[model samples]
Structures are given as C-alpha cells and as structure tokens.
Target: MRLSGKRASQLALNAFIVLLLAMSIYPMTILLFGFTKDSLTWQYNQWLPALPMWFTNLNYAWKQVGTAFWNTLFVAAAATLGGVFLSSLGGFVFSRMKFYAKEIIFYFIIALMMVPAILGLIPWYLLIKELGLLNSLWALVFTSVFGAPIFGIFLLRGFFSSIPEELFEAAKIDGCGNFKLYYKIAVPVSLSSLATLAIMQVMGVWNDLVGPSIVLTSPDKFVITLALRNFSMSMSGGGMLTNYPALFAAYVISSIPLVLLFFFASKYYIEGLTSSGMKL
Candidate 1:
C-alpha cells in the first residue's frame, strides 16, 4: 500500500529506531555466537561465525562456572533477603510511627547514603578482617547487606507512604495488632515494591566485582564476575591468540541467570514502580 507523507515520516522514524536497536544489540549477539563457535578464527571471516554446532564449549564452561555461579547466588540471595526485610521494616516504622529523634535518625541514614563507598572500603575491610570474614562469601554478603540500606529504605519508604492510612485503621478496628497489621496488610500490599527492590539488590550483588575483588582473595570463593575477569586475564598473552570462544562461552553462561530473573520479574518490576507512586 502507498503511504501519505505523514505516514511515511512515521514509518521512517520507526525504521530508524529499529536500526539503532539492532546496532546496539549486535555486539552481544556476536559475542553469544562466538560462545557457541568452535574457533575464534571464524569471527574474523563471517558476521555469523560457525558455532561449535555441538555443545562442547557450553559443557566445558559449565564445569568451572558452577562454583562461581553458586557463590554469586548465595551472596545475592542473602543480600536481597536481608536488604528487603530490614529496609521494609525500617520503612514501615519511619512512615507509620511517630517518635522522638525520628527525623534526626532518618537524616543520618540519608547522609550515610551520600558517602562514597570507596571511602568506607578501608574501614569495612578492617572490620571484616577483625571478624574473620575476609576471603569468605560471608564477607561479600555482609558488605552488600550493610550497603543496601540506603536505597532500600528510600524506595520502601515511598511505597509505605503510598499505602492508605485507612487500611491500617480498619485493621486496628478489626483487632489487628501492630505486628499483625504490618505483616498481613502492609506487606501484602507492598509486594510489588518489595519485588522491584529485590530485583535491584539481586542484580547489584550478583554483578559486583570491586568489593568481592578486595575481600574474596581465594580463587575458590570467586563470584561469576571475578571468574570472568580471571578468565580474561588468563586468555590475554603477549603476542598470542586469546581463547575468545571459551571466554565468550563463560560470559554467556554467566549472564543466563540474570537474564532469566529479569524476564520473569519484568511484570512485577513495572507494577512496583507504578504502585510506589500511586497515592493511597
């Protein structure tokens, strides 16, 4: 069908957006293809490199990837659980309860958020060392848990505020105590925000490299990101070929969990943001 001038302009604009999207995604696509390929040489010759066509690369990468994957999983899970629980509790208190020095305490938490992470690294390291958590997954988990309070508290407070006070009053009238009201009413209503914050915390803890790099000195304790760095370092040689295919394979494997989590949580994630802003 022929298009009018305005229709043609809109089509052209959409085509441009599609082109940009493809360009942005091409590198990742190529890297994924490289992961399946038998040899890195194929990358130089074709846009669509010949993959292993068999599954050997994936199997090989998985052998070492499992340990790192688990390490990351443990840290991320612990951190997200701790962060969501503590932040949600704190948010509820700040939003619902009026008490002495509340504003002062809240401002202190906000100020803590403003401090650069690097500035606290040294003291954190010392504390972890003194506690004998250095070089252990607990170090990573604890560090993330402590670091998460700022944004977690902030996001959850907004969510708690968005909840109607009438709900709490109604619950109280129905003989619900403070704990029961928080657990049964507020928490159920704030599920979306909690899920969103959980997603963010999981992603952050899973992908963090710097903190783990300093604390986890043991190779056995390496997370996926650290393992990827180690793989890259080992592949780089003076005037020699890198094992691009293997490294790419590792990269692809490492991203699967994160990609799957986001896809599964996308609906709740959107709902969370919208609900956090909804008044009453």
Candidate 2:
C-alpha cells in the first residue's frame, strides 16, 4: 500500500510539472498559432493552427523591422564585446593586482549598483545630448558599454580571485607579464563567466525599449523594440482595428535572434550563471 501511494504521488507530481510547463508556454503557443494563420482565419478562430502558412505576414514585418533589426544586432553585439572586455579587464585588475586604494575603489564601483538606474535617466539624457549623440546608435552602444559594468566586475572579480595563486606564480616564474597573464591565463579560464556577462549585456540591450526611445528620435536609428512599437501602432489603425497575425509575426521575428543566441550559447551561459550563484 505504501509503495502504491508513493507511485501515485510521483505520478501526480509529474502531472503537476507538465501542467505548469504547458501554462508557461501557452502564450507562446497561441502566438505561434496567431502568426501562422491569415486575418480571416484568426478573426474566425482565435486559436489552433490552420492550413497554408501565411508567409506574407513575416514579409511585411520584415520590411517594417528590417532596418531596426540590423541596428539592434549591431548595438547588442558591440555592447556585449565592449562590456565583456572592460569587465574582465577590471576584474583582473582588482583580483590579481595590488594597487593603492584598491579596496576603496572596488567598493565604490560595487556601491553604484545599489542605486536605481531610473534615477540617472535625466542626467544621462542630458549628458548624451550635450555630447551631440542624440538619435545616434553610438549613443546606445557607448552607454551600454560604459554604464553597465558594475555587476560584471563584481561577478568576474569573485571568479578571478578564486583562481589559484600557484598558476600566476608559475606564469611569473616563466617571465609572463601582467598583460599576458591576463589575456592568456585569466581570460581563458574564465570564458564561462565572460560568456555569462556577454549574454547578459546583449539581452539587456536587445530587449530595452525605454532607453532607445529616450535617446533615438530618428526612425532609422530606432532599435527593434521601438520599430515594433511603431509597426504595431500603425497596423492597429491607431487602436481602432488590429492585424493580429502580422503583429504577432513581427514579435516572433524580433524574438528569433535571442532564441538563436541562447540555443547556441546555452551551455556556456548556464555554466556562467551557476558558477556565479545567479538564479534564473
């Protein structure tokens, strides 16, 4: 009787897990159905797939978001590379090197993370405007790179400091210099952490709507999020009528790159997150 009860409870738990997973993915599944069907089919039946995949929806969305897609890709990629490089370098400096007021400076950098980002929006905007970077992609790239390194530094610092001193001592014994030790030894071992930082930076830049909306006024300079917002507004006839299929298709298209990024880097990304003690 105990074994049977155990088996029943195990089955119940499995069912609950499946239920939760379905609930989680239900919205995306509906989005897929919406994007796959034509306007008439969607209007008639809001759920379930229909025959003849509507490629035109994607084509129209592509035409609308194509420029912004490339712009976002460039900005995300640039920010990822720049953030990883700077954060890793900063991590190495704090971890392996001894310098004057190092503890104080490191603590100061970490303290900045406690402050709310929204509080700096106005000042950041004025600074960008003063630099004549308004409506420029460079503005986004520069700010993403420079403004978001605190957490990365903290993460990488802990990882770098955990490295065995014997390795650095051996490298020094072999006449390896500081820069070589950094690029050759410290970085190679911390690729997972660096990958984590890159993934985070890219994701932040990719999904950000408000920052781009604030900095970029030109349609051509707009990122994917901004372009999608405009496209959705236009397709909806100023909120009177809406094209569900095309708008959903645009959302799906906007999501593909991030999905691909994770699909490829998921191994490294997972490792980085686990090692850094981060949840989700």
* Global lDDT of each candidate: 0.82, 0.89
Candidate 1 to native Cα RMSD, angstroms: 3.1
lDDT of 2 by residue, 94-205 (tens): 9999999999999999898889988999998999999999999999999889865799899999999999999899999999999999998999998888888888998999
Q: Write the per-residue lDDT of candidate 1 for residues 1-280, one digit (tens) a residue.
A: 4558889999999999999999999999877768766654554643575634646777877776778988899989999999888888888888888899999988888688668888888888888899999899998887778777787787788778878999999889999887787789878998878889889889898778888888889878999989888877877882346666677788888888888988889889988777666343
TM-score of each: 0.90, 0.94
Lowest-lDDT window of 10 residues in candidate 2?
232-241
Model 2 Cα shift for residue 34 (angstroms): 2.0
Q: Which candidate leads in TM-score?
A: 2
Clashes of each: 2, 0
- The TM-score measured for candidate 2 stands at 0.94
